[model samples]
Target chain A: NAGVTQTPKFRILKIGQSMTLQCTQDMNHNYMYWYRQDPGMGLKLIYYSVGAGITDKGEVPNGYNVSRSTTEDFPLRLELAAPSQTSVYFCASSSQGGQSPLHFGNGTRLTVT
Target chain B: GQQVMQIPQYQHVQEGEDFTTYCNSSTTLSNIQWYKQRPGGHPVFLIQLVKSGEVKKQKRLTFQFGEAKKNSSLHITATQTTDVGTYFCAGDVTGNQFYFGTGTSLTVIP
Candidate 1:
């Protein structure tokens, strides 16, 4: 059903480059989240949106920003990518916050050089 | 800071052997969810435990939520090659966000 779709499965960015990570869900969920996973580590939240026009910072929100303009789209932007931003970015959505199980995207592996 | 820690950062077990991974949270959680990510894939939701001291089984996997709701465990009864993946426990400490554990990478030797 393509529950959650993410673009650019892999990318390489030069230092200070900016890019956007696109995420969309067809489930019409209200909760959406962005998380990054370093090599051999767990996922860490970057940003989240509870509903349209609402966004919030997560544990690791530096160097990144997010916007939720529509019910189906939550995009994460990297204003000035750094070497430390190299990680696997995952987009997830759930029917509800916390109570519902999350549906994650295939993930985008970003490498900042 | 609500942190979730998992024991045994990595595990290698022979096929047909049992394996278990533990997840402990710094703060009490209202619910804990388990997810598994295969090599080169994203995390996939496995199950969730809400009630205190709750236990649920799915095929060969068993998930248990401690009575205190601050700890959880995932046990695989008879592991196989297909079970090779990283297991992560995500806790909902405030019913608004999920803090994922450090994760336990499991490898099954066939």
Candidate 2:
């Protein structure tokens, strides 16, 4: 079974461009999160959803938006990309918040020039 | 805001040597989880420590949680090439948010 799946493994965008990074999980998890990792740095949370129709901003939520329309899908939207947004974006899911281990996707490498 | 810091940002060890990475949090954590990410790969769950002064082992890897629940450690014995990766410790603090440590990048030489 595919635990967590992310589309467009790699992409390059010009400044001010907009795009959506799609993430889906088949494990029936209720909590999902979006994180970005820069070189030699830890993963920084961008957005998270407790369940369907519920979402919250994270530490680095600026310039990004997220929507949780279904239990299995949590998509991260970059409205106007900037050079600072060039990083590896990871999607993760857990059965519960703060108590379960997170299952992560391979991640999408985004480069904004 | 809660923060987790890891020491020795990068470590290089011989294949048969032992390596340890320490993680400290500014605030108490409900639980701490460890993950390992290989080069050009995603982060994978290694282990989770919940109780105070807890220690768990996975083969050659040993994980420990401090008594105050604000610190943790990951020790790898007799490291091999397969042990090369970036190790991260994520702390679950109040408000259900995770604060990830800067991570320790390990390079095991053959």
RMSD of each: 0.6, 0.8
Q: What share of the true interface contacts does each candidate keep?
A: 0.80, 0.70
Q: Model 1 Cα displacement at B40 (Å)? A: 0.3
TM-scores for every predicted model: 0.99, 0.99
Q: Please give the distance, in angstroms, between residue A30's alpha carbon in candidate 1 and its true position after superposition.
A: 0.4
Flag clash pairs in model 1. Answer: none
Query: Per-residue alpha-carbon lDDT of model 1 for A37-91, expressed as tens digits?
Result: 9999999999988999999999999999999999999999999899999999999
Q: What are the runs in model 1 whose C-alpha is more than 4 Å off?
A: none
Instruction: Put down candidate 2 lDDT per residue, B1-110, tens digits, no spaces.
Output: 87899998999999999999999999999999999999999999999999999999999999999999999999999999999999999999853568899999999999
- How high is each candidate's interface RMSD, in Å? 0.6, 1.2
For candidate 2, the per-residue lDDT at A29 reads: 94
How does residue A40 of candidate 2 score in lDDT? 92
